[model samples]
Target: MPLHKVININSSTTIFLWKITESFEDLFDEVQLKDINLIRLNTMKSELHQRGFLSVRKLLSHCGYTDFDLIYDQSGKPYLEDGKHISISHSHEFSTIVLSDQNIGIDLELVKEKVLRIAPRFMDISHLDNLSEQDQMKKATIIWGIKEAVFKLKNEVGISFTDHIFEDPFLLSDKKGTAKLRFNEGVEQFTIVFEEIENYMLVCALKDE
Candidate 1:
């Protein structure tokens, strides 16, 4: 399928989402990959992942970019040649990219029952209190994405989801929240926005400035 959705988070930030319905060959034939990325693509063992990677390239094309315009830093954070900050994420059959003039991170997660089972490990379990099992799963997934997106934005080592990131309680209906990163003797605030996309949670984090 073509670009599934385009979300204008603000005047300066935008998100593009793609539903991965094409086979690996279809995606690979559509996008040109840099030599290094070509090797990385071929080395991937999972075909689903390969398709996801190429799907990201397809998304780049939608934004008037190619694989050559996308580069990664030493910490494996992606950036655009035009000096825009970009964050990439793919889960199950969905892939998304968010671009902003400011620091940003994004995460896409398929809602699953397993998140509730392990909620205690990474989040404040009290946040899940008094919610239905289904709601618990969705909230847990959102919190996990919150931590993951924050980590991607920071891209620093030794940041633990359970230890360094804290998410404020929010109802599933709110569709937005806030979090704090208490690391390196500093406290950084983030504004979080999320949405439900066909049983998947698409979460974005931006530095509160």
Candidate 2:
């Protein structure tokens, strides 16, 4: 019942976030999962993951859908039976989903100093220059979320975060930017938006038409 936030990105897109605070039994009793998901849920070894999975179902209900109306591709990307695009993400105590009429991707990540340590692996570290350590961690986490969102949007084989995706330079205060995917002998662009949610960063990528 901890429906944390609902963001109306546009007329056709919205994001829902849930702060996981319910016990496993409480969530399990509330969400009616499909047989496959039930089996899959039972197989999760981590209780946090189980809670995250169940929390997503709570978000689905908020959007007027159910487990029965959702399906996943061979790549494990989730989609809506009504043909609306959907993307999901969770980390630690939070879970989020973005439902849009257009192809879109979203990511939720906890801000941590660890991301600053791995910044070079997936982003242009120059973007982090001139910022204090705290700001750097926040910006790095946002960049990581940008790459993850783009990856979910692409959902292709052989896409390396470091080798394939590139985020353009933007101020952390801007809260939105652009990125490019250079792969398969073609270039595609995406509009990126992000916001700070408590101690976590929430990012969304919308494929350019």
Candidate 3:
């Protein structure tokens, strides 16, 4: 499955992972080509599996974050040097990272048939029944991304996606909505936004706590 190419919103902090639709390799200067080393490439491949991480780095530079002051924490969780809350996610053909003053999580998924194969694993029975035939594939992808984002936000809180499924009904409308994500502890609320980008779907979760 592939993501449709479209910019959804004006995120104060966002990094869209373009599918390298055409290998804009020509966009780079000769100097950049010379700097490519096997070691650097391997690190990114391991961290992001050779998807769109290089583009993410380019966007980060454009966003004025040149420090590259990020590191994996003791729990193997990734964080930033300036103490800014951070979240990173990459799947299949795309990868995106978001840095924000507030805790944030983002996920992008290709809206396709593969979701049907794995639908039972992540989505509960009720969610599947709620989908309409017209955009069921697109709607299904949204739920997956939403749960992934919620898990990223609460990983520190020690909850898994299976138990802490989003309580609010899945809203696949173009507009955004708020939802409750919880497992055992008090409910943790998040603002959920679903955006249709090309053929892919993205769901972002920003926690207010």
Candidate 4:
């Protein structure tokens, strides 16, 4: 019931976010899950993860769907029975889903200092130049979300964040930018939109036409 935010990205696309404040039992009692997801949920050792999983179902309900309408490919990408594109992400107390008529990806990440330390492993360090340490962490977190969003959008093997996905340089104030995925002798572009949600960064990538 803690629907934190809803973003109408366009007439055909929307993003839903939930702030997890319910007990696992409460969430479990509220949402109905398919047999496969029920088994998968029981296998999750962490209650936090279980809550995140259940919370996604709750978000689906808001969009007028259920676990029955959601399907996952062998590559672990999610799809809707109605044939709309779907992407999901969860971080700490937050979970998000982007539903669109076009191919899209969404990611929610906590703005942690650790992302700055690992910046070199996943992003172009030059993008972090001329920024304070605080800004660096925020920017790095956004870039990480950018790569994750792109990966989810591609949902292909051998797409390395550091090696294949590239985010265009942009200031944090921009709130939106672009990225490219170069792999398998082809290049694809995506428009990236992001926002800071409390202590988390929420990013969504829509494939360029």
Instruction: Please name the candidate that would achieve the greatest TM-score relative to the true structure.
Output: 1
Q: Can you tell me which runs of candidate 4 are displaced by over 4 Å?
A: none
My TM-score estimates for the predictions, one after another, are: 0.99, 0.98, 0.74, 0.98
What is candidate 1's TM-score against the reference? 0.99
On residues 1-209, what C-alpha lDDT tens digit does candidate 3 reach at each position?
13324343345545455454334343232113213333455556343354354554454454445325556565656677777766766565565666667777788787888887776777764766756764777767887788888877767666656666663665566547666776666787888777776677777788766
In order, candidate lDDTs are: 0.95, 0.94, 0.62, 0.94
Q: Model 4 scores what on Cα lDDT?
A: 0.94
Return the lDDT, model 1, position 205: 98
Q: What are the per-residue Cα lDDT tens digits for candidate 2 across 1-209?
A: 56899998889999999999999999998989999999999999999999999999999998899999999999899999999999999998999999999999999999988997788888889998999999999999998999999999989999989999999999989989999999999999999999999999999999899
**Count of backbone collisions in candidate 4:** 0
Q: Give the winner by lDDT.
A: 1
Candidate 1 C-alpha error for residue 118, in Å = 1.3
For residue 124, give model 2's deviation from the true position in Å. 1.2
List, residue by residue over 5-92, the lDDT tens digit for candidate 4.
9998889999999999999999999999999999999999999999999999999998899999999999899999999999999987
Q: What is the model-wide C-alpha lDDT for candidate 3?
A: 0.62
Model 1, position 70: C-alpha lDDT score: 97
Q: For candidate 1, give the lDDT of residue 158.
A: 99
Supply the global lDDT for candidate 2: 0.94
**After best superposition, candidate 2 residue 57: deviation in angstroms?**
0.2
